[model samples]
Target: MGLVVPFEDKNPDKGASIESLVSLVSADMERVNAMILSRTGSDVTMIPEVANHLISSGGKRLRPMLTLAMANLAGYHGDGHVKLAASVEFMHTATLLHDDVVDESDMRRGRIAARIRWGNQASVLVGDFLLGQAFKMMVEVGSLRALDILSSAAAVIAEGEVMQLAAAKNTETNEDEYLAVIRGKTAELFAAACEVGPVIAGRPKAEQAACRSYGMNLGIAFQLIDDALDYGGTSANLGKNVGDDFREGKITLPVVLSFRRGNDDERAFWRRALEENEASDSDLETAIAIMHRHRALEHTIERARHYGAIARDALELFPKSAIKDAMLETVDFCIARAH
Candidate 1:
């Protein structure tokens, strides 16, 4: 749910054409950036220092861009989109800070994580600050419906985090449980961020529901790709060390499938490595090899492609435009990253 800098590959067919979305929302993005900078400032020096560390890092701000793009796709021409976009970014950034702490991560966006730079205490407090600011911006927009959606999402995300914490290190966690965790932790905000765009745009209920569906499915696809990438991707691709999920004992779909399908010896290996929290780098290599043996990563990506297709189909009602095409390309990019 952190800034997933989607496939940056130069090939037109493989990349997400993120530049298209950027160009379409360029001016508005600048305003959102300014809003971010202004809102992140504080009289307390440590607050801005910790907040800006991750904010200033090269996060693509994809979630906020989704907000802006959805608004545009809805034919919106109001100033509300800018504030809402900024608010969505704040919510995402806050989650990243908190997620790193919970995951005990050392890197983010190819740099030292905020929790590593500042203490976990500072990172968490700053994350709370960002959430407060995000809500403030949402309130300023004056749309009760939008506020309701986002506020509910914030709670759902918290619930997702708790669910994940409970499921951590448990190899018995099923695919359904994993899906629920990701849907709450990751997709809830994506749905909220996209849905609010149409809500503020005064689009119809059908359009709002479609955008929410698109965002939810896309978010699921995004997380699935990320889970696959953790085992197979390079540092350049994920901006974090490979095997982080394994190291953290995260029960991703890949791990769930592998554990369920593995031989007794392989299951023991998973227990010793993941459940026991004793995996070394060499063990990570071995784990990935076993996942390949079981085609865990391959099947996980297939699942991602399924969700991506659903995401693409969710946009069928929208008239074709640059924004819609870019959004569609985003689905392709999400699946392509696994390749």
Candidate 2:
């Protein structure tokens, strides 16, 4: 399927805003928030301090919100979803803490990274602490199937991180390899988050699979847009410095495409900047210019739109409802951020 029609044309009044989804899950999110805060506390003062540093940062909390919304859409009527949603957020936060350390990032949500503030040792240990809390909350939920799904996702996400590390600065990384990396690191948790909604609600296996597909595709689209934004977006929108990827020698799709389309001299430039790690201050500007010349960022966004269409289509199994509409609009909202 293609992405031709704009979200506004499809829903003139609502458009493609996440506010609708946020509002749909607001009450459940309040409980999720409470659970998150309660679980973050620890006797070791540094744990809560480091964890809260990133937790209080102004993230949209989209993954947990998805869990809450999907559970509501499946007609759940219990407190299990609140814990599951909070678990999702904790997993996401933990991933961020660990990722910042791995990526050697300096900023998160426009503030100094927890690793930079507290040091890498503290950041990693607190991430481990959050993972422990997440599993505790998951076990409390009392669903073997849900626990299995999320626990497997944690392993998959770790594998994805290792895969990305192996491929880092390797200009030979292909589209297929990159896709596998994202599926593991980013999409698996999203899939698990949405899938558990139907499991807790006692919905059919088919419904559970559908939500999994929705979350997986939406996550792929989300990451693609994020990678593109590294080149084309501003720091205000990204919550981190633009061109960080280039400076760090990340082998993103934009770099891959530009490397393939560039001439010998341009390829040499990429190898020096990305592989050899010899980028000067002006190199980031050159990287952006090359990506723009080859329309790498634009094509990356097009690929995101493609996955977004699949995410929207995955919801065709469900009947019409406010929650379903909000979910569909959320796909648009994610893709629209690139513009």
- Across residues 262-290, which tens digit of lDDT does each residue of candidate 1 receive? 99999999999988988887888788788
Model 2 residue 14 distance off true place after TM-score fit, in angstroms: 12
At residue 282, what lDDT does model 1 achieve?
83
Badly placed stretches (over 4 Å) of model 1 are 1-13
| TM-score: model 2 vs. ground truth | 0.95
Question: TM per model?
Answer: 0.95, 0.95
| lDDT of model 2 at position 25 | 92
Q: Which window of ten consecutive residues has the lowest lDDT sum in model 1?
A: 1-10
Looking at model 2, the pairs that clash are none
Clashing pairs in 1: none
Cand. 1 Cα-lDDT: 0.88
lDDT per model vs. reference? 0.88, 0.89
Count of backbone clashes, every candidate in sequence: 0, 0
Name model 2 segments beyond 4 Å from true: 1-15
